[model samples]
Target: MEFAGCSRGSSGRALALAICLLALISLSCAARLSASSRQKLDVHKHLNRLNKPAVKSIKSPDGDIIDCVHISQQPAFDHPYLKDHKIQMRPTYHPEGLFAENKVAESTKERVNTQLWHVNGRCPEDTIPVRRTKEDDILRASSMKHYGRKKQRTIPKSADPDLANESGHQHAIAYVNGDKYYGAKATINVWEPKIQQPNEFSLSQLWVLGGSFGEDLNSIEAGWQVSPDLYGDNNTRLFTYWTSDAYQATGCYNLLCSGFIQINNEIAMGASISPVSGVRGSQYDISILVWKDPKEGHWWMQFGNDYVLGYWPSYLFSYLADSASMVEWGGEVVNSEPDGQHTSTQMGSGRFPEEGFGKASYFRNIQVVDSSNNLKAPKGLGTFTEQPNCYDVRTGSNGDWGHYFYYGGPGKNSNCP
Candidate 1:
């Protein structure tokens, strides 16, 4: 009888342990489900904030949805400072010595570039086109807050080569310093350079800089870029970026944030540009001009000769509220150096500057806006490259093209390794 009682006791203990284990498993699965629910809710809330109610929507061939949001209801007004801000319809003054773009030679006129979305439809006169953000776009980011924002320390620090190298960003640039600048202009050659990794990107841009190259740097950038991680494709797109505090918390790409106000209803930021340049083929390019309005103190951006896109409010910056200390123009590529070797991503045309002309990428007719609101050629222009063997730059000038440079190269050459 005593032996039988012991067996019963042992069975009782075993049953209790089994019950306890089952309870723990249930709790864990419930917790996981709750966490996943919270993430979905957060993503939806963010999408609601960014994608305002659209009066009309157009679907582009490239799988983009363009929402025509009312001007007053645009994202810029979401900022506390812009809550009561009055939109400036036009700049108080345009810089003199504008390029005669209409007089381009007939041979080069075949290189016209346009946004891919134009083939579908146009936004209404009183609305601005915004590229609608999708759930996958948010999920692709490391986090919701970092979506549509650049990683920190991406700028090329010309004064500190060591710091530039540590940042993993390579550049072939022409820069001007030692004087206050109001703005900058460049005609950038556009090409869809092959990106080896989704996280890496290639771009040709002009940087208008203020303050030192440290934590307090201010910058306004506009250019053409091919970033698969950012846009989920290899198509070259027109993009703009600004930062009042060196890209920490103050800015975002295009209109993903609430700082830059878009006044024009035609061109949509973040849309793909068609007719990219090909090697030894007809070359295509885009002209970007970013200048500060002397009277209003706001920074204005003009794309090509027709579209005066919009402006960054004077309140959005500190040092740039007055003038820029430096201007840089050229190509930059993110070199992640996968597998302990240089990446195979291409910058610009992915050909050395020595190739020249249609075979290489070039920035021509570079200019800077002076304090007197005049556009003039930069003085004492200097070039910089982190790894000359992997990428390089060469500058030249003439009566027709003014000041220009051919720059870029394949990243993972034998010498680069």
Candidate 2:
């Protein structure tokens, strides 16, 4: 009878323990569900903030939704300082000595680049096109708050070789410093470079930099890129980035943040550009010009020859408010190979600068705006690359192309590894 009693006690205790375990599991699941629910709510709230009301919506072939938001209601006005900002419809001063289009026409066999969204519909005059941010777009980010932001310390510093290697970013760039630059212009050769991983990207751009390359640096960037992580696709897209504090919290890519004011109803900031350059085929490039207004001190960007895209108000920057101290133009790629192997991602045309012409990507007509607001060939152009075996840059000048450089390469080869 005592043995029977002991057995009963043991069974009862076991059953109670089982019940306790089940209860804890249920509570844990409930907590997870609650947290997930809150996260969904926050994501929706962010989407609501970013995807402004549209006067019209056009679906592009590339699966992008372009929303025609009223110019006054753009995300730019969200900044507290810009609450009373009057939009500068046009730049007060235009840089002189723009490279003649006839020169490009006579030299290379090129095609015109257009945004995919233009095939469907057009936004009205008083509205600007904005790429609609979907829930999946935000969810693809490491976190909701970090969506559309470059990782910290992504920009290359010529002085800090160690920092560039640590950041996993490699560049083949042509830079000019030691002068007060008001603007920069480059006709960047665009390609849909293959990204080895979703987290990696390849781009060709121009950088207007100010201050030291430290935490307090200010930069304005414009170019074309293929970022699978940011856009959730492998399409080449037009992008712009700015950071008043070295990419920590100051800015975001394209129209993802509350800064650059867009006055043009055309050219969606994050939309895909079609007809990327092909191997040994017709080449395509886009001319990007970023300059500061001498009068208002606002920085302006012009796409191609026309299409004055927008401006970053003078107050958005500290060092750039006066002028840029340096300018860099060329290709950069993120090498995120986990196995210590070089990434196979391609930068620019994925062909080394030695390939030349249609076989390699090139930045032609590279010019910087002088203190007098006139665009002229940059002097003392210097090139830098972390690993020349992986990628490289070679510069040249001619009457037809002005100051030009052929750059980029396939990221990983026997030598690079």
Candidate 3:
């Protein structure tokens, strides 16, 4: 679900002065607290509204669910962290498989499948609406003694902050790093699964990160998610999030923040995606690329074969101002077991990778941008699963796919539950 950023070192005296300066400067900008101190902030005050029944759920004319809670877009001038940041729409640069001939002004939803959310993915005038599920994610986690399955597990301050362990109930993932990475690319399959709760979601994504996870992690993420609170449907949708400091206040869903500039009119970050092969097929896949524009100092995201969406301005990040130190890809699912049983919702497809190629879901053509700005296959690909019976990953090499892997499994099974 998220990458725990790598750490950095600086001179003790210099670091002290920098922290003081950063605090003074960030008080008027985005002042980030150390990870330990950050969690102590009064998060309850910010999330209390989540329980209000006033926040109603409604349906769009197209029948898509809308958890009508619109998080007001913070004014650019008001964001202490990312103030007056650059946000814009650029000309479309078709990615690899996207054909200009098949290009449509609107998404395939208008022609091939049902249109959900905003027809063109446009939110209200200045308000950026996100899946109500995001709110649920925050509230649900906060309501618990332990953080929700995903968020609590990510922070080292939590009881089981270790991402490498096998206790399962993962908000878990695998990564490659120890160097300054520029970007990461992966082609991930999209699947819609049966969700058990309004707050539960199943996702598989790529995380390109700079800085360490504790206090100074900056990240750019993209992938497919079946999150009802956010999208209000069982249809898996393409989604993205960017943060200058961490996932807390600086970043949000797709264009929810005034940070990620959207250029492609054809694809919307959280809009429902109608995979060409449908949820049950092995053919549906989308290649995602996130790279830094060395010349412009901006981070860009490219989708599929053609749609080169907008970017996150460099000023919005610290480590990402130049390059990332780590890259991660894999699946994450919420184990919202009310009665202490595993959730039935699935990750990728509800099937095991042991089911074989066509029957199982996968990520292929995985690559990363080297410091030289080359799209090269990743080195040292590794896999991690919290529960072997609940989920698993198998890696392989082939000329066509490069560093690729097949991963997925039902959340509920005799051994898992």
> What is candidate 3's lDDT per residue for 150-209, written digit by digit as tens?
342242111224553322345335567777777788877666766777777778889888
lDDT of 2 by residue, 187-286 (tens): 8888999998998999999999999878889999999999988899999999999999999898999989899999999898988998888998888878
TM-score, cand. 1 vs. native: 0.95
Off by over 4 Å in 3: 1-61, 64-174, 276-282
Clashes of each: 0, 0, 18
Query: Each prediction's TM-score against the native?
Result: 0.95, 0.96, 0.67
Question: What is the C-alpha local distance difference test score of each model?
Answer: 0.90, 0.90, 0.61
- Residue-by-residue lDDT tens digits, candidate 1, 1-417: 233223457676677666667878999999999999999999999999999999999999999999999999999999999999999989998999765544653446677688998899999998999999999888889899899998888877886787887657899999999999999998889999999989899989999999887889999999999988888889999999999888887899999999999999989999999989999888998989999999999999999887999999989889998999999999899888877899989989999999999889999889999989999999999999999999999999997788999999999998888
Q: Rank the candidates by TM-score, best first.
A: 2, 1, 3
RMSD of each: 2.9, 2.6, 16.3
